[model samples]
Target: MVRAFKNTLIIFSSLLFCFAQQEDSLKVGLQSLKKIESDVIIISAEVRSGNLNPTAYRFSVFPRHRPSEVYISRMFFPGDSLQVVLPENILDADSLANIASLEPVGGSFEKSYKLFSKQSDVIDLGIFDVKKKSDIVKLSVVDGQTGSPVLKPTIKIFQLGKVLYQTVLDSSGYGRLRIPIDRNREIPLYALIDTDGRYPLWRGSIEVSQGVSSITLALNSMSLMIGESLFRVRSDLTPFRKGPENGSEILFMLSKDDHIVISRSAGNKLYGRVRLDLHTKKSSNFFHGWIRTKDVEYLETFATDTNHD
Candidate 1:
């Protein structure tokens, strides 16, 4: 009987020991895992590389909810450690409908971060200010470090949520984006560029600084061909600027002679929209430009910021 008791105790103890070992092993494995997230006036998302290469890559931050899909595609890199800026207005959060506190990662890429020769923290939106002859969008970027300006890496602009203008900067590291304002204002403008991964180095919301003096509407440059109609906003207080460019009836005859200036652009090719001046209430004219390889090249080559390069 005693021998039987001893055998039973030994079996029980062995089982307990094996279980404890497994628990300890699980704890160690958990410790090896890393978690990165934050709340408040900031966002830190894991950068997943859907696709990558020496010249370009596809990347994005998650919470993709809509037709936008909101991703970074075709990110050009010079190859280096990159620094990115969180757009001041991008703290967009929504109360979850009791979805899990944290969304479980479906899957992830191999590398946590990447390095490139040319990385950017500053956002240089390539645009032409056609608003007033002197229209300008003044933007400042803070490096991953203190509020210093990183002088490398080029900034590209994606309007209406995609790239339309792109320019390289000079030694000063300042990029001048001229809306040259002659496009559709119906859609909101979204800026994007990769700092290191496949996402914007910097993104933000900007508007014409308070008065007419900040920007000038270049009326003389307005050339309406193909019966493009220019529309004028009835009011300046509201962001809604309606006219032909804003999706109104195109009165080709009335729009031809009207001189409209470029306000902002949202996209490229047939998918793009341009916001024009608000002065032409009677016309339906807006921007219709070609953004081929040559157009992209012209903008990049003529970039005012390239003096240093």
Candidate 2:
């Protein structure tokens, strides 16, 4: 009886801790949601503890691209008031912020401005016309300082608010996208890099027009993961904005066994991957594999067993 009580206490404690974390996260998200009230918003979070003394860490806020009228967002530190954190060094970092290093903190148009066919600005496959492909928005991420193509990065497509498709970017940092268009569709279509939920380093948006034949968007140059692996991948669901998350959950079980990746490990801890694996399933395309966290966790448990033995 005592042992069962102890286990119950442990589970309760874990659940309470998780609840608190989620609540705090929601508060932070609320702060962010209040700030974006413009067409384009760019924010960067910088951690500075260096010789720069005036402000240790700051964030640069861009309401628009004028460069003159800048708004620095306030980073709330628990008990502290929401203080403006965007100082000079931080802004400079944003200008040169690499893909992996830059923990960006901004979002474009709110849920108000429509970005697609008369629907909300989220990604859900069910509401879209599956076969209606009219416009193709192409963005090529490249080295920022050097005008060369960034080879590989993970890119995802969202409709409504769900992930429809994702792929590793090609040698040109380009993810060729096809989104269906209806006359009711509005402008301000969003393009984002899925790494940390960032706005498109480059973008394309329209005002939901009725006077166009077919539209093509070209994204500006940006730097992504320099060492991100570019493995051969094939999937029936390409990064089309109008595809289902999992085609047929019952056509096969949703087990984690199908996933495999060539991830590098650091001292029994796997951070991510620079060289990944790709597999071709039956009657489908070969698609790049993800670093399976479940597999890694299982490995960690096995390592513990090995140590005990």
Candidate 3:
């Protein structure tokens, strides 16, 4: 009986030692986590808008190059504010200049804020006015050459790199785009029209006015002149030069994947035009300039017919 009692006591002592070690390890781990959390940068903002629901929107913070490391805010109530935590160690100095965006769950519009590099721990952005989707814009897409409706076209409206609205047009090439209004005024946005790869993509900036309801877009068709060939910019920051040579002055810079219509070519240089704005009137809003041949790739070419007017 004495030997049995000693064995039982030894087993109990060993179990107690193991539990104590585990408890110490857990406490160390928690301390390490707390330290890490304290080292992060927190961005807090109160969303202010009529009929605002905290659960219906989300806040995101991420580096431009490292989108996978994006930190999103958790769902909170109306009175509680939204907070986004960005770890300092994981991001470099350049990545510290991140982008903070607020978007709705249904994706009506996205408002982006550029975060400057600051050493502060907590950055409090005062009441952010979230725009509500209260206005409607009617669009009519037609063929540029024929002046007839382009049936069943797909339309996508973009604002700050996010698709604000997407819809397919009806048989009459008409679509009503529902978008957000800011301060009861007009806002500049982008529009992209696709016709199931039948025609070249029509992309241009547009001004959405508060009271204006309708706009028309004309898409150049494949039956047009061969000089109207479409080309897409192959590199970012491609300069639109005033002349064909490298020594020419740059009118503006074009982003990668921007489509342009080539009008002419002068040895290794191409003269093209990009649509700057889409208007309801027939007057053109294109920016015509010269770009290097190496900076763009041929997308499509229409048939050679200069007689049709």
Top candidate when judged by lDDT against the true structure: 3
Please list the C-alpha lDDT of all candidates, in the order they appear: 0.34, 0.34, 0.73
Candidate 2: tens digits of C-alpha lDDT, residues 211-303: 233322322222224332212112322221111232312222112212222234334222332211123111222222233222322222112
For candidate 3, write residues 108-206 as lDDT tens digits: 444646564445587776566665555688899988878899999999988777887799999999988877664324446888887754565677787
Off by over 4 Å in 3: 1-134, 159-162, 180-190, 194-214, 220-230, 255-267, 271-282, 285-289, 301-309
Q: Assess every candidate by TM-score.
A: 0.23, 0.22, 0.42
Provide backbone clash counts, one per model: 44, 19, 0
The lowest-lDDT stretch of 10 consecutive residues in candidate 2 is 109-118
> Which prediction has the highest TM-score against the true structure?
3
User: How much does candidate 2 score in TM-score?
Assistant: 0.22
Error of 3 at 204 (Å): 5.3
- Ordered by TM-score, highest first, the candidates read 3, 1, 2
TM-score of 3: 0.42
